[model samples]
Target: MDSETTIREPRAADGGLDLSPVSRGRTPLLLRFTLFAIFFFPATMVIEPLGASGTVPTLLCLVLLLAWLASWLWGLHDPIPVRHPGRLAISLLLLASIASYAALYAGWTGGSTEMTRASADRWLLLLAASAALVLVTAEVIRTMADALQLVRALLAGAFFCCLVGVAQFVFRVNPMEWIQAAMPGFTYNGGDTPFQIRGSLMRVAGSTFHSIELGVVAAMLIPLSIWRSLTDPRGRRWFHWAQTALLVFAVTTTVSRSGILGLVVALLVFVPFLPRLVRRGLLLSAPFVVAGVFLIVPGFVGTIASALGADTSDPSIATRVNNYPRVVQLLDSHPILGSGPGNYTPPDALRILDNQYLGSLVTLGIVGLLATLAYFLLPGIAGVLAARAAVHPALRGLAGAVAAGALVAAVCSMTFDSLSFPVFALLYPALVGLAGGVWRMVRREADLRDDENAATARGAMMARAPAPTAKEVG
Candidate 1:
């Protein structure tokens, strides 16, 4: 490759020409740990026995915060990329969360109580940790290669989960229970049942606390895996395609209507950005793919059909529909700053509102709601914009995948408390941070190209000058 092309290429730490600002300098240990943890998050769940209050994700966040603090104290923390619009939005959201929590604690919101106060405090801590994560991720993932590495990790994690889910479905094994049994203190909130059976087919939840959560994760991965399969070189293309199949199977096996819808939404967001041939091929193959799956597992098809049809008789759907009015009433009572995060009491037997948007409104109020929306939407918009401007094909595809994942999470939030879940909560924001980093990299490359072009033009003009040097010298 030419020097200009080499400058645009993504470089690794192993002797390649490092063009990324983040990669140019020695990466801090804490930042490296955070990056590694994020990619291997699924495996990290196995260490839940060490988590506070039996919540592994919470423990991980705490560790992240401590690492960040230690890094700061040691003067190893990189500057937060505040110039990135997505990062700026996240910082604003964190500030708003703190303010809202303070207002709730002081009874300024009119709905505050001891329960709300405690809940708000916990949420505030989580927000702080999440802000730190965003900052660290943006600082660390400064190139297309870095972003792609994270995506590959996510695919690997998703593939493993899918394999576990498949085993759970086929063999009726409860891996969570098995793990808890092996380690006495290891506990999970998922039920004792091996799988969730719906319409004569077994639903697989994998290692996540719930089936819906697994579905959401699978939905987010599908688009990204598809993009990778198409764009990756021949050596790795088949592997990514296989991963895509596994992810699709996992999503279907979850028997989650919202999950399917989320996948559809993500594909809709992703397809427009794809090459014409790939787009056409996907559109044409989708039906055959569905038909083939149905041929293999007819019972699974029934479950999907029933779920998609919005069967009012289905207990889950009925519960969600029934809970909508109560959620609205709760939101009405606390329209400003909310009662507190995770503090809204359900009016009925159902404990979960099942809708993240409504739950946020009731718990965090209008200000928090707006902030949450900005946190999610701003990064998604930034990803879409970055995809348009990205010079590298892989970077552009990765940006599109990020945007799709954000949209999928948003769609899933309509049916589940997606933002509260560990995988969704952490992964979504991290992807946004990655998107912001990619955007900055694209902008820098564009600026450099412009400067190079301008310099070349100036040199040409000087060469074309009519004997100006000889005349001036004389």
Candidate 2:
């Protein structure tokens, strides 16, 4: 039958493809919940006090974990079939994290109370949840269209945060405080504050608990927005451009040097993947646009200079430099399985390590550090490889966007404890999962096409073959 005839064929009475309104275009309920959780991660902090001591993000993660497990156990009718990747690397990573947590718990000689240890255990749980997120997202996103939809959801969340951040920056107001006031026991501290001021400008945090968190989210969104703007049809391009503009403004208003650097790295990673003409246009216009920005916002230019350590007197840079040696010393003390997760920095120090690599080393030790690196790096590499393999332009573009987002996470990790922050922890792995899913979908389509082409070629050969001669038949 022709393709159109096959598609329109009615379902068999034995319960085949159902074209009814209830089934048509309907997303799985579990998948819907997972996407909602991912998009609203920032609001998790508001529900921190609702569930017995653990933060709301963790609780939500637990809910996701349960949902994923239940779906697996009950075989709840999934529309997209899941393809599992080789699990050796992921298994080893999880094993290392668990081993390190056990060692740390057993060798607890520090003055921290039982409550502290309990809280530290949650970090281990978060690690497991992150792994589960990768698996779940990989299964849910089954096509290039699905991947783009996921990106749009992420961008929408970031756009909302940007709007709130801009308002906070301009009006010197924080909506979180009002939410806290109206809702008893909802204590969230991430907002605009005097300490977030850089030079003469105040930084805005939006719904996240810190300006840096908002900055990181905006940085990650910038490249994705750019990719959408470049790849989308002319009719829809304006929406992506608007998202890109908002994300850029949000990043600048946060005054995060790391965020700015991360954006630069992301753009660098993304530009090569663009169509040649688009790439050339972007490269040509970038310098003029940058100059215009510097002229319009001199303060932002100064902040960038300071972030690059151009100002010898910038205390933040000096502070980070000074902390490196201290972090190294801590790592040396617990080199194998460092002091334990969340125990590297003492209350006396009055600051957590700003560097994620060092923080992992000091807390989880060498084994944990390696595992953490593998967890972050493997999926990112897979995404880039997938981008190279994709035959469809839309699939290739989505894969490139995923890789760019991963690059943002990588660059930002050097300057912040990215894994510890829910915004990065959740979004990064989810994007990686989405990339893997898209890759699988593309491969499946290619395989099916190849099969069809081979079948057609064989049929053509048979038709073109000469009939047996009468003598041969006799």
Candidate 1's residue-wise lDDT over 45-78, tens digit each?
3344333223444455567678777878898855
- Cα shift from native, residue 386, model 2 (Å): 0.8
- Can you give the lDDT of residue 284 in candidate 1? 100
> Could you give me the TM-score of model 1 versus the true structure?
0.84
lDDT of each residue in 51-144, candidate 2, tens digit only: 2224545555667778778877787746245553413335556787667767766775252456647656667667666666667667766543
Error of model 1, residue 443, in angstroms:
1.6
C-alpha lDDT values of all predictions:
0.68, 0.65
Cα deviation of 350 in candidate 2 (Å)?
6.7
Top model number, TM-score: 1
lDDT of 2 at 93: 64
